[model samples]
Target: MSAMTSAAPPAGARRGYPLIAAAPPLIAAVVTAAVSAAVWSRLPDRVATHVGGTGEPDGFAHPAVLVTVSVLLLAGWGAGGAWLAGTARVPARALYCGALAPAVLLGYLSPALLLANAAADQAADVRFPMWHLAVAAGAALAAAALALVLPTRPAPEGERGDGAAPRTSTLGLRPGERVVWQRTVHSWLLTALQGAMVIAAVLIAAVGGDTGAWIVLLGGAVILALTTRVRVSAGEFGLALRPALLGVPRLGVPLDRIAAAEVRPTSPLKDLGGWGYRITAGRRGFAVRSGDGLWLELTDGKQYVVVVDDARTAAALLNDLIARRSAHSEG
Candidate 1:
């Protein structure tokens, strides 16, 4: 096992996380239901439910059916958020903002759907205004902004002062010798989230006949591609991380650019905010799960971190390689 999974996070690391994350979607569902009720009389017998690429209604359903589906979807989304919160693996604020942004976007769309149908003589005549998409995007942005400003618990504190110093001469590489260290890191939380997306996609397909199901499946695929596992490689080339599922989307820090490398304990949620290819303030890196991570102090005045098993060896190897490169540059 990697050092990344050796230790558990602090108790109550996830306290109040579920409620805060789930609130937005549940509230959005209620608001959407209220709007549907207010315009119930104005809505045509058949309401425009789905639109095509042309921004025109391509599918219709009874108002009751439409509202029921919308409410159910929102409820399910909220449930998923709550479920993710229980893992205690991601930052609370991240979950809150993520939930709010999507809830607000969908909320705007639901009402726009009703208003568009209400103004039409019949469902077939309803024109799904393209501008409504812009409004939804703006509303989502506003909701995300609100999430940032709203009072919330501070990030969980990490165990500090456990950092290991760079072993610059540990390896003592021989002339013409080549050395490399590699490890693969995985995240159970990410795997579970992808599984949930797959299940949700199946449920949506069963009810909605593959209309919105593909989008959910696509999202799952994206998560799988990016967060399934990461391959960490340290050699004369310095440090590199590549998604196990894809070849092109990779990160690398050249040997010349890295000033030093060491091992340090980290909190994925607290330190880096959340996992999987993150950039925050002065430091940036991939953190699938966290414990002892390889911390790099770059020449450009920035830091990089990646959680991996046996990070000491990787760091030591990187430090040794950096020393060798520096010595060769001077000689």
Candidate 2:
């Protein structure tokens, strides 16, 4: 990826939100309150609030309590949306949908709750309305459409730029020289954390008989196994990043696509926005930890950065390879 000499703009500079992007959640909150008020009287004192897999009411709660819960949930969602809109990484469209999703859910589910509880005197008479599901789905689609049409903030200035001039090769490769530099990186802390999570998931699935929990644990295990060790190499062919076990390259930057290479210090969370395989509009990164790394700028204006030890040697080798390729092309 292209590197920036200057630091990022202050968080305060990125805090504004577009009116269209901010309106949906507010509108949804108001509609939820209005609908709740309108149906407050028709709802029973205690409604069949939760249904089991067999389509029977398994739990009951007062309608007022449910409305209160919905209101609280909407409030929490609104606050979260406001916070998310201020962040640079998250897309406005995603924020809009996420913010309004709770309201849309409660809007249809509230009425459905009343319908399900209408014949509370006869428990067997209750049936969920498929129309309510359709209505909720339609509302969600409309919100998503609005989010798509809303204008988004421009990408930040200095997000990408030609980095500093290349340092001389540490490998001392002369013009037309070809050599390879390779290294493997691993993060013990991350691996341990993931392992702990997998164990917890396994235990929960065993005790609770949750097939979904078992699936989640298995997926985590697979990811942990794949990501524990990464193999990175730089040669005349360019740079390749792959999992050690898989041996198949997941990312490759050809000699021609690479404009420059540099070794630079980085913050995993602050710079790359947290660990492995991060993709944004302008750049992609494979960041395992906070430290120095080899950064590459491609001809197409995108960047790829990977955090690893021995970055100085790797950057030098990559630069030499790119220079050799360029000289050969000129001849």
Candidate 3:
């Protein structure tokens, strides 16, 4: 049996972990609320929520509505970042900075809208100054800088000894034997989400919203094409992952580049910070749902993981192939 433990954080890299998860969004929410309240008396009933290419107001919403949406968006993103930081095998700095930059950008934008609309009689009269873009960009940059200086504790490495040992032995095969293993991994959550997005897009179009509806439709289509399900295959081409719907876009690792392969348990949320395709520090893979996964250790030192059932057979076949290739090269 093999055991896994965390390597200690590099000297001087370890520091006290603060409440960074809630800080950025909470502070941004407070700032937005304060700014909105201060400008309430001077603002028009409607605010320009969307601007066109020339900085003219093209879409409008009630001030209260805009503020509420902004706050929710900020909080939701921050929560996701925080959860990923805590559970996903990713760098904490990247997560914190990623979360803060968007929160700061939206925080500036929410107040900037109110200020732009202040003292205006109608939403159409509001002009979003190009300078506001520069300001928002600068604020996001500033937040990123702050994140760099803030103390961040490294994410804990996952322990491995608790589970059953992965299938590490190569499969016994007759000379000149050939075999192919294939499995389809599906995510019900992604399918449901895709349907919801399409329905929402249709609803928005029915209500006469053009830009937003098209955006939603495009998002749904992209999600469906890339993430609803993946077809995994291990054979002469080595391990591959391709969208079950359309096989054109494929992710593959050649046999020559794989140093080893094995079967291991994995979690979509805990290991990959939610589903779809994911890349972390030294690993990248397709994560549809959590279960047995084919873990490939590449020649370049990076790791690849793809969730699938019956990963043991895949791993055994891969190892046999690797051994055969090595023997052929030696011969």
Candidate 4:
């Protein structure tokens, strides 16, 4: 574990689609129904006549279908956010963002409406705004990029008060054998995953299928897979990595950094704006579940964090890290 320092890693950007974070209950349904109705209204007389409505057709026989579809779509968004939120193991906060990226991307994209409009294209003279679609997707992509980018900083001074470890006469190398333990494979794998996800999204968009939602769904699956993690160590305060599909490492917040942690079963649209490590308007750190370990706050605001699966391992690791830090300072 590294010491908490003024040179700690910088935080990722906090921007995402609100629609995907926590879709407010009635609002999403109502909006879906309204959008459906508005789309229906825009059709030429011929198309509206063909749907075979009564004296007055309300989008469908009723708004039930629209509402149902809205719920399913919102569920998708919530799932994506939750999956991303689940991957916050210490040192892997970026992965958590990757996991929830699709949802964030699709949140403002209005997947349901776009698909429906595309399906109804022949019936209506009007078209859904391509501008809206582009903006939404672009915003999501930006958020995804922010979450995955690794935070790099010059190594902070060791507790012994120097930037490098103390000289050991023993490693058998001359006086100058530097060890650079950069995590190469791990970083590459994550970056490749992001590329794969981008490719998948592009393919869906090009398919010209019923809205480009297939891409979002595919991305969501990748994100979820990235979140499931295992404990790499056992025994003190906490240390574990929640994997991700970006060029970022796992979340590895020491439990000691957590000033407080709480869990709230939030609605897909009601809370948790976008994804990643979110500090709600009320200042609560939300991970998908307590089942997975989450270190919310840092004692010094300089440590990394993760949403890990093994709480005990995290606790033990944190303890060990603190001991090591203390030993160095005392020595």
Candidate 5:
């Protein structure tokens, strides 16, 4: 196939693309970290425990601890968000939520943990676990809200692709076209698994009448809802996924928003908090629904990932896109 060249960005606006694009993840990370830090620092000096007298007071900021933990949390959230923006075969919503979840968790949990520890001398109270639950609830609500906020960049003047809204015709997947198919299949598989989980969860809720089962069901529902929307489009745009309760979700992206693309098998367990759209540079990247796939590094410093049916094929397609884009730009 002939490599095509990309047209240059319009005068005065070229430089802005990089900056604008980078803002999403960077902002998400910074904001999340700040919020988390603020929450962490608010624990009660002496939390009562079941053991006995309350232990020594706890301070949220140990300066060093605050910086270290905040940095770590920020990095995790940023990587996760960018990864989703770049690859996930879905929309930025999922990734945004992904980032927000950890931030909220860190904010509330870290502090709560300290409080729990502080109160430990008094007794083996439920402070720690209860705090964890509180953190989880708050995070869930916050994530839900933020994920719905949606990240959007201007679609280039003449740009369009699979990630675009919708069409009257087929998805435009043509034979012999330079494209990635594995990710689609993998995403579909994940969708199927999520569907099964949701079904099992529903069954458990119905047959078992257990709140735990209901909670599990809800989780599966979230996954199922997330999995179905991932996809690559006829347009040259990269993978995108939009979550449920979010609009007419689909696997989509704006062609111009893409910054970079690459391929690498991840230490699913070690690098990411364990697969399913993991993100972090040193230890993370967006990965959705498991397995090896393609990695897209957006100008936003976020890694959007797609689980490819064939990694080799996905790499070839990405190389083609980069070449085409570069060529088009230089033309």
Candidate 6:
């Protein structure tokens, strides 16, 4: 489909988008409140507010303060998320997931914090079990995975290949003319590494009787599975990178913002600081390994690169789309 065809809705029409997209965060807030209330009486008058590197509580605060702060932070987070969801050019699902992931984290942390401090003596320094940290990290990861897999509106109608045959273009394409190139990239090394980590985590948890460790391993496995294989696509909409499992473009560059694009060799370590979804000094990239990929220079002077095979075709199509968009703007 042509990039322009899926242009963002008007501002007036988008006012409600925030409310709808804010549902997850709002639900999270409600869950937080309920959990907090349920544990209120059991919580210590002063709860552990800060933990040192050694996993011991170094500071304390009133339970009321913690709950208030959590609520305020959640509100601010939700508002910011709503704004981003309404404004960004990427898919709403991506925005929703991004926003919801943190909400889920906060939701889990609030109650865990209260429960952890409930048994602490008022006279002694509270020492939280180190395993709780692992649990928090694991919960966050699980939340993120859940967000990624959560269903959203299906891809817009006609986004799939039309009955028309594919055409090639170098300079530009006619209005309604479309070009698409897609390739799936896989990394066996990363997969193996993740598998080893998962195995180690599971073994450790089994030996130590740590549920948190098991959760962390499960979360790690989910993340590894989602990211091990990526599908890169370029069409009228510029460029997109999506995990094969979710089939939703988590990263995208709109054609309107693309100044130029080309296929070029890349170094994941040198150019992008190694690995998937990297942001270096001046460039952002969704890279998996080091190889040829589509590189884009945006109108805002930022650069984006994604490592994928058949990048030559994707780059050509992208440049052509940008040219067409520019010419259309001029005319």
lDDT of 3 at 246: 86
Question: How would you encode candidate 4's per-residue C-alpha lDDT over 15-85 as one tens digit per residue?
Answer: 23222233432244345556656665543322221122222222321222333345455554454443343
* Residue 238 C-alpha lDDT in model 5: 57
My TM-score estimates for the predictions, one after another, are: 0.54, 0.48, 0.51, 0.31, 0.34, 0.45
- Candidate lDDT scores, in order, read 0.74, 0.64, 0.71, 0.38, 0.45, 0.66
Query: Deviation in angstroms for 48 in model 6?
Result: 35
Kindly report which residue stretches of model 1 are placed more than 4 angstroms away from their true locations once superposed: 1-158, 161-169, 207-210
Among residues 3 or more apart in sequence or in different chains, the pairs in candidate 1 whose N, CA or C atoms overlap within 3 Å are: 2-309
Which ranges in model 6 have alpha carbons more than 4 Å from their true place? 1-176, 201-210
lDDT string, candidate 5, 98-145, tens digits = 555655665555445544544344323324444456666876687769
Model 4: what TM-score? 0.31
Candidate 3 residue-pair clash tally: 0
**Where does candidate 4 have its weakest 10-residue lDDT segment?**
165-174
lDDT of 1 by residue, 92-159 (tens): 55786889999999988997898888889899988886888989999899888887787766645642
lDDT of model 3 at position 185: 87
lDDT of 3 at 3: 23
Question: Which candidate model has the greater lDDT, 3 or 5?
Answer: 3
For TM-score, candidate 3 versus 5, the one ahead is: 3
The all-Cα superposition gives candidate 1 an RMSD in Å to the true structure of 8.8
lDDT of 3 by residue, 133-197 (tens): 88999989998998788775543354343454654656675569998888888855456546645
Please report the candidate that would top TM-score against the real structure.
1
Is 2 or 3 the stronger prediction by TM-score?
Answer: 3
Using lDDT as the measure, the top candidate is: 1
TM-score winner, 2 or 5:
2
- TM-score rank, highest first? 1, 3, 2, 6, 5, 4
Per-residue lDDT tens digits of candidate 2, residues 1-331? 2222323332312445533334555565566667767766655656666776666677665555455455544544564455444433456667666655655666567656665666455434566656666788888778667767777676556332235333333456776555777788887655654665566556545444346755886687778878768898888878888899998656778778988888655545555676677887777788766456578888998888887877777877777677777778899
- Candidate 4 stretches greater than 4 Å from native: 1-243, 249-275, 280-286, 290-292, 301-306
